[model samples]
Target: MLIQLAIIGLLFAVFPLALVLISKEQNKFRKLIAVTLFLTFDLIIFGAFTRLTDSGLGCPDWPGCYGEANPFQAHSEIKAAETLLPTGPVTVAKAWIEMIHRYLAMSVGVLIILQMGIAWWKRKSMRHSPWLPTILFVLVGIQGAFGKWTVTMKLQPIIVTIHLMLALTILGMLVWAWQREATQLVLKLPPLLPRLLPFAFVILVLQIALGGWVSTNYAALACHDYPLCNGEVVPQLDFEHAYTLWRELGRTGSGDFLPFSALITIHWVHRSFAWVVFALLASVAWLSRQQAETKQLGNAIFAVLLMQFMTGVATIYFSWPLAIAVLHNAGAALLVLILSVLNYRVRSSAVPVS
Candidate 1:
């Protein structure tokens, strides 16, 4: 099964590998990094889809479906499970979804391994250090461990949330590494902009964490109203249970069924903190737009911010439709990607150009 899975991963990576090899660009290594980053972005999006559809346990195992390399081989087992619980998490369709997500993740791991190999081989001539890819390799390994725990632990809320956050962290790191390979831009901006960009990045990370908490806990509809949760300025909440972090999916620390008030707490905190994220990020975007070098990226940040806000509200108003919720997750990843680029540029500007 492991060999078959390895072969499948190689097959999935072939197209991107071939693209890098055949590209006319002088730096094939850099091209590979960009392609890996693009696929990582897709992986994060598809990961969201898998989670939103409740397919995380479709295979009921790690790295394969029912000890097989792909869902087709596990059809009988999946069918049996589905027959037993027709609306359960182990349906044939969900098995496929979950396995495909695993396949994509493995392919990304394969690509990163290739990146590390190439970086080491070309270390002398390469402009960027190889250590970043090495670190990314280690991070992907840890992420894969979390992926296993996500299933083995029965979609434990905290474990799942950390998995989501780790994926985004890898994405952000790739963005930073990729940007470092690009032509350096030195912008003479107001002193505050450089300081603000990193601060904004930190704020965004916290908001994403809170957002992950909301999703993993299935609290999207806890309020069922916009701007005002449950039709009140401040709904009754149980933060003690909501933020416990070490419990099961829908149970409190004491193993009782989690209360509606706890879900309300999770949803409300995420929704409320979003305004702070928006204000800070939007201000950074507005300030960035004033600079000639960063204007386009600033515009993109502003646009995604609006899209994120709309989709976030729509998810509540529309009762968390799968597509919109997945898009909301994608938007968050996109924001991370964009902010990574902006932060890299802003920080790079500080280096005294020789």
Candidate 2:
């Protein structure tokens, strides 16, 4: 089964590998990095879709569906499972979603391998260290491990949240690499701007973690109202259980049914934190506009910030439409990308290409 899975992964990965190998672009390395970055972005979105559709356990297995490489081969088993439990996790539609997500993940892994290979192959000619690709290679391996844990562990909130966090981290690392390869002169910013950006980045990271908590815990509609939670400005909440890090998906650490109050706590924290993140990011965007090189990025930050706020409220007001919820997740990722790129550009020294 594992060997067959390996072959399937290779087949999926081959298309991107061939594109990179046959490309006529002047800078093959940069082109490959860009393609990998784009694919990773798509993977993150698709992952959100998989989660939103409750397909995380579609196959109820890791790396393969019912011990088969593809859903088609496992259709009989899947149909039997769905027949026994019509509303359970292993429907034919969901099996396909889960398998497709795994295949894409495997393909991204192959691209990272190609990146590391090429980085080492041309190490001496390159201005950047090859270790960047080497590290990404390692991170992708760790991510694959978590993907398995997410399934085997039955989608525990902590594990799923960590998996999501790591994906964003991987995306940030890729953006950093892309900026390094496509170096352009960026104007110096005020000293305070440098310091403030990192602070804002930290805040954003925390907010994203909180957002993940809400999603993984199924707390999106806990409040289902704007400017208030459950129609109360200070809704009753169970913080002890709600914030417990190591518990099952819908149970407290003590194995009790997770209370509605706990879900309220989860939702409340995320919504409240958004205000702080939005304000700090707005300040950063405003300050960034003072410098010519960073002006466009500043605008991007503000635009994304607005989108996040609107979509966030829309999700609550509109009762969690799938598209808006997914976009909210994507907005968080775009926020990470823009901030990481801006930070990298600010710190990097641009040299004339002689």
Candidate 3:
């Protein structure tokens, strides 16, 4: 089943590989890295849609939908589940969604393989370090492991969240690669801005984890509206249950209700953290706009932040609409990717060449 799924998945690699194959450009390697990053970004977006829609376990199996490569063979099983519970997590449509996500992931894995191959092939002749692509290959392997764990564990929140983080990490790495490709120096140091950029990156990562936690726990609707949650600015919370890391998928450690306050706490904390995240990122973006090398990047970060802020509100006020929620996740990934580029460029460009 895994082999078949991988074969089916390789279809996605055709276009990008084709571009590298027939391009008239002298430096196909750099273009290949950039294009791979672009496609991987799209995959991360679609993966968000899959998880948000509760399609992670649509197939109820790994590498295949009910021992079949495509959802068609598993139609009977899917129909059985849908008939049993019409709107439950497992259904025909969801099966398709999950399978598509897997297919895209496999395609990306193939591309990464090709990238590493080419990188090693031209190791001595290449201007940039070969370890760049080599490291990407390792990251993709770790990502695949988490992907399997996500399904096998039945979409456990921590596992799923880890998978999400891995995807974003891969995006960060690829963006770094693209920056290296954009310039001749892979080891170039970037300018430091008040020593606050890296500090912001750490905080942003925590915020992202909190947001993912909120999503995985289905706590987004706990507060329902901005500035107030359950009609209180800071309602009574059950942080004990909310922060219990080793609990089951939806229940407390003892298999009880998990506490309503836990949900509120989860939602409220993420909401509060948003204020900090927004203010800090906005500052970083503004400061970046003053520099020539990072100005455009800062502008791009601001644009993504706008999209992030708007989509977040739309998700809440509009009742977690699929399009808006998916866009929110994509915006988060883009924000992370941009910050990574900024971090690398800021450090790389600022280094003194002696």
Candidate 4:
């Protein structure tokens, strides 16, 4: 089964590999990086879909569906489980969703491995240090570990939230690595802009983590009102219960019923922090627009920020439609990518003059 899974992953990975190999780009290595980065973004989005659809437990096992490579091989078992609990997490459709997600994740891992291999093989010719890809390989390995735990641990909110954050972090790191390898870095901003970027990045990441926590905890509709949670500015909350670091999906740390207040706390914190993150990022965006090189990027950031705010509100107003919620996650990922680029451009040395 393991060997079959590996073969399947390799087959999925080969398309991108073939593209890199055949591309006419002067720097095929960079093209490979771009391709890998694009796929990682897609992986993150699909992961959000898997979580939102409650397919995280569709297989109820790690690395395979009921110990088989594809859902078809495990069809009987999946069907049996579905029959036992028709509305539970193991329906055939969900099993496929979960298994397909795994396949994509495995494919991304394979691509990262190839990335590390190529970086080392061409170290002398590569502009950037090979260590970046090496670190990314290690991070991807860690991500796989988290992926396993996300299932084995039964979608425990902390584990799941960390898994989501780590994926975004890896995506950001890849963006940085890509930026480092660029042939020419045209974007330039004032010194203060770069200095402010890291702080904004940190804020954005924390906000994303909180957003993940809200989703993992199923707290999206806890309050059910936009700008005012539970029809009150400061609804009753149970932060101690909600913020407990080690607990199951819906229980408090002490295994008591996680109170409605706790859900309110989770929803409220995420909503409140969104404003802070938006303000910080918007400030960064305004500064970015002042400089010629960063204006476009700043504009991109502003656009995504607005979309994020809109989707966030839409999720609440529309009572958490799956598409809007998924788009909200995509918006978060997009924000991370844009901020990562801004951060990279600010920190890296000027693009070499042509």
Candidate 5:
């Protein structure tokens, strides 16, 4: 089963690898990184979809479905489970979803390995240290471990949330590495930007973490109204139970069923902290727009921010529709990518070119 799974992962990576090999660009390394980054972005979105669809336990195992390489091979077991519990997490569709996610994750790992190999092979000619890809390689392994824990640990809220965060971390690192290789242009920006960009990045990461916590805990619909949670300025909250990070998915630290107030607390904190994230990132975007070199990225940041806010509200108003919720997750990732690039540009601007 493991060997078969390896083959499947290699097969999945063939298309992107071919694209990199056949690209017109002179910097195939950069092209490869870009492709890897693109797939990582897709992986994050699909991970969100898998979670949203309750497909995390679709396989009930790590790295394979029912100890088989693909869902097709495990169909009988999946069907049996579904028969036993019609609406449970195991089903044909969900097993496929979970397996596909795992396959894509493996393909990404392959790409990162290729990246590290090439980086080392051409270390002398490359401008940056090969350690960048090496670091990414290590991080991807850690992310994979978290992915396994997510399943083995029964989608423990903290584990799942950390898995989500690690995916974004890998995405951010890829963005930073790609930017370094893609361009060397420097921007002339206000002094405040260098200081503000990192602060904004921190704020955005915190918000993303909160967002992940909400999603993993299935708190999206806890407050079914927009701008006002359950029709109150501040609904009754249970911070004590809401943030017991080591507990099971829907239970308090003490093993009690988590109260509605706890879910409300989780939902409320995510939504409320969002404003600070928006204000800070919006400021960064507005400042970025002032510079010609970064104007497009600035505009993109603004657009995604607005889209994120709308999708976030829509998820509530529409009662947590899957598409909108997934979009919210994707938007958060897009923000991470854009901010990474912006930070790279800003920091490069400060450095005196030798």
Candidate 6:
């Protein structure tokens, strides 16, 4: 019952608005993609918030809560469960959060379907490549599968991390498609740094993967302090438990409760590699400053990096407040977008033949 309503609500919320955008916009295709990409990024950030808040299992059911599409519809069930367990995962608030996440996910999927429909209709147009949207359609489909797998598999760390990587991949692809439409083939790169942009993307991808791992593994509080963890020089390590595969989402290989040390391991790795990522982004921004089209993108990346850093510190000092955590997620997604745009601008914007 709740699933049906959520699906209907999502279609109404997303498809109709996109149709309106298609009809009213001068560049309907670009506007549609822009809006979809914006929403996708927002969804990813909210997913992070959902996970951070332990709302991943709030509904404790996939696509619905207690077989209801939305929380409101499942109020009775949620209340019953709350009464029975008292401290269980099926509270009304949690069910609402989880269902809202699902609703947003479905809405984004609807937008992608619209994007693909429009792309197919305009397939014959000489200037646009329909393949980009087509590829995004396929990617979104896979992302949906991962979304289900993430829930059904009990939020397996690997599955959740892969889901995150998929989201970033979708963001990059959309930016690429948008760039292809926005820019003509006349873009030329500065001769000094032809290879830098792609390299920067590679670095960003690695860092983003680590960030996903950190988030999925619940390592955010592994080390509550900055610059050092646990007031120790190196911090007692537990890579075996930290990197154990095929274990429960938050458990260790030996079936013992995951220790703070293991969390510290995950957190430290993310923090340590961040230095390298920061240097790489700094270089990319510096290099882009030398180019005409990417100058603004580079500056934006630099600014977002600073904001991300501040938010990271705030999450620590402020005891992982929800706003800071959500903002950190947003900042991370924006960094991905800025880097993605910079990548698209540098890659697709034609370069002089050597």
Cα lDDT of all candidates, in order? 0.92, 0.90, 0.84, 0.90, 0.92, 0.78
Q: Write the per-residue lDDT of candidate 4 for residues 305-333, one digit (tens) a residue.
A: 99999999999989999999999999999
* 96-126: candidate 5 lDDT, tens digit per residue: 9989999999999999999999999999998
Prediction 2 global C-alpha lDDT: 0.90
Error of 1 at 323 (Å): 0.9
Supply every candidate's count of residue pairs whose N, Cα or C atoms clash at under 3 angstroms: 0, 0, 11, 0, 0, 3
Q: Which model, 1 or 4, shows the larger lDDT?
A: 1
Give candidate 3's whole-model lDDT: 0.84
Model 5: CA > 4 A from native: 351-354
lDDT of 6 by residue, 1-354 (tens): 745865665774665465655576677677777777877888888898888877777887676777767777778888999899876666777777777787887777777777788888878873776777788889988998988888788888988888888998998888777767674645555654557767767877888788777888878887878888868757998888888866777788667888878888888888888888888888878877766766787799889899889998888888889988888888878887887777666556647434
Least accurate stretch of 10 residues (summed lDDT) in model 6?
183-192
Predict model 4's lDDT versus the native.
0.90
Provide the TM-score for each candidate, comma-separated: 0.98, 0.96, 0.93, 0.97, 0.98, 0.91
Model 3 segments beyond 4 Å from truth? 184-194, 351-354
**Model 3 residue 236 lDDT score:** 98
Please identify which of the two predictions, 1 or 4, would achieve the higher TM-score against the true structure: 1
Instruction: Give one digit per residue, the lDDT tens place, for model 3 in 119-171.
Output: 88988987777787888889899988988888888777788888888898888
Query: Which pairs clash inside model 1?
Result: none
Clashing residue pairs in candidate 6 (N, C-alpha, C atoms within 3 angstroms): 2-68, 2-69, 3-69
Q: Please list the residue runs of candidate 6 whose C-alpha ends up more than 4 Å from where it truly belongs after superposition.
A: 1-25, 86-88, 185-192, 350-354
